[model samples]
Target: MRISDSMRLDAIVRQQGHLKEQYANASRVAATGAKIGAPGDNPVGAAQSVRLQGALDRIDAFRESIKTPKGDLDQAEGALATAGDLFARAGEIALQGANGSLSATDRASLASEVDALKTQLVDAANTKGQAGYLFGGTSTATAAMDAAGNFLGNAADRTAEIAPGVSAITSVSGALAFSASGGRNVAADLDALRTALISNNPAAIAATVSTLDASRRQILAARTDAGLKSNRLDTADAAHQQTQLSLAAQRHAVSDADPTTAYSNLIALQGAVEQAISVARTSLSTMSINKFG
Candidate 1:
């Protein structure tokens, strides 16, 4: 049971060092509000936190990725709405021009108005949005219609990923919206209306009314499809927000410190460290040069 002074001194030093380390760890946890400062502190929780953080990062990425598509769709909807109004106006002019009482001068004046409407419809069809041409399908780098109101884009719809394993179409098919492929060609119909009025052909002008009606329906249909896609994007966004919140909570639970507990532990560890220091100093003082001699 006889212990050497060197052994007693070594034991005291080791105990003091251990107490100091514990006190430092508690202090850091309290100050930073992090339960695990390093991977070694809580390996399982830290690993889980890393995974949850990755999930949150992916959610944020998806959120950013959908912005362009959303903007394009909104712009496309507005353009389609304008196109519809132009078609309605064209229909009204066509009905007026079909009257037999109107002379060539009046018909010519109406033709000029119809021509202007055709130009406006072309502009609406080739409208540019945040992500380039709103109706350009996959060919968003260029205009969706030519100067003569012909289709320049395809029927291919562009899409965007809004969430994991979920995607939604962001671009409408220009060909389907303003070309013959979509049941009626809006621009061509308007041009025909103009040509019929200029020629003073009652039958042709009357026929233009039905054609313009069909073209109007096509625009309405395209707008409806775009609206449905927008709704889907909204749903995806809502779901993403919920997932992000859940992931944030999960990561915080794994990595965040309990402030109350951390503070109490810091106080207790500080007291233990102070006591260890006091005992070590007292012990060293007792072992003076007189006692050793």
Candidate 2:
């Protein structure tokens, strides 16, 4: 078979072009440190990476949502603890006021202390958190109680999305925590206790002990609920972190280039291009000699 000089030269040019393309692709992979720069590089792996990234993005959002609710629950638990202590002190005063040895003057002095405790308890009930009042349910823009011991907040519970298709309650209802909805009106019970002490009524003072106990229990139960919700947020965050790590690893496997392998391939392709150029130079020189000699 006879081959023309033009055909031989054309074949050499095509071979060099192909080698240059391979070298450019290797250079891009080395520079970017990515195995799949485009979907065409690895369609299956690219699709899998997209799904994993979507899952990671959702987990990130869930984690961010968990933060606000966690802060609110912590503040709620602290406020409830303070309320519990105030009730315990009020209980002590009730016990002392009920004693027969105590005079009216002594009971009056006790009543003054109870008044202070009532003010403190009200302040605790109106505690604010990251969003707003912790016990105000969904009505977080206002105080949960008024100075006159009336409940101003609603009974609706606030919630937060902790994971995909999963949510957790993040608020304690002020109406349930401090009003008769939970068995007794906590502030009203304090008011009654203070009134009994001021009037030096032993029987009335004695009657308040059980109601005070019930109010304390209600606050305790609310605190427990807040604690449980906080734990749920923590668990969800941990799961998100774990899933993120797993998804990131999977994404890396499908999309990232190994540094060692990429650099090695790039070096090999570079050498191949250089060798192709040298071969073309030698071949063209020989062809020119044959054609002109």
Candidate 3:
């Protein structure tokens, strides 16, 4: 086969171009300190890095969503504890008022104290936190209970996703905490006890003692539930942190390049390109001399 000088020159050009491209790739990797600058470099690793980054972002989002609700639930548990104490105190006062030996004036004074306790209980039910009223269920934008001790919130349980396919309830039920369904309304019970005390109705006061005890038990139960939810959130948060750490490590492994190795590779490619250029120049000079002679 006869080879023309033009063909030899074209082959030299092509070889030089390929060498330059290799040197450029190594330089880019070294300068940028990345093993995979583009998807074409390591297609599988690039795709995996993208997926890991997306998972990490989702975990961050879930953490952000859980923050306010966790605080709100904590406040709800605290409020329920306060409410329980108030109900217990009310029960004590009811027992004292039930005594026949106590004078009517003493009973009236006790009734006044009970009214104050009722007000405090109302405040507990209306407790607000980061997301507004903690016990307001899904109606967290407003107070959970009114001054009259009437539950202003609905029956919806607020929830948040802590992980994939796992949800945690983040709101307390005001109705259950204040006035247990099919049971006595704690606020109304306090009112009845006060009215009974003022009227010196011993039987009604005795009845209210049992009702107050029931209300206290209900509040305790709700508080227990709140505590469990808070624990779930804590567990989920820890797991989320672990997941984020894992995703971060995977992404680093997939995309991050060792600077030392990259620099070494770059130096080797530079040397090879320099050698190829020298050899190409020598060959071209020989060809030119032969063609002219």
lDDT agreement with native, every candidate: 0.87, 0.89, 0.86
Please, what is the TM-score per model? 0.93, 0.95, 0.86
Off by over 4 Å in 3: 1-12, 99-101, 201-203, 278-293
Q: In model 3, what are the clashing residue pairs, if there are any?
A: none
Task: Give per-candidate clash totals.
Answer: 0, 0, 0
Q: Is candidate 1 or candidate 2 better by lDDT?
A: 2
Q: Sort by lDDT, best first: what order? A: 2, 1, 3
Q: How much does each candidate deviate from the true structure in C-alpha RMSD? A: 1.8, 1.6, 2.8
Query: Worst lDDT window (10 residues) for model 1?
Result: 284-293
Which prediction has more favorable TM-score, 1 or 3? 1
Residues 88-195 of candidate 2 have per-residue lDDT tens digits of 999999999999999999999999998899889889999999889888778889988888878889899887778888877878777778988888899999999999
20 Cα displacement, candidate 3 (Å):
2.6
lDDT of 1 by residue, 174-249 (tens): 7888999998978889989989998999889999999899999899899887787777777788889999999998
TM-score of decoy 1: 0.93
Cα lDDT, model 3, residue 150: 88
User: Distance (Å) between predicted and true CA of 16, model 2?
Assistant: 2.0
* Model 1, C-alpha of 70: deviation from truth (Å): 0.3
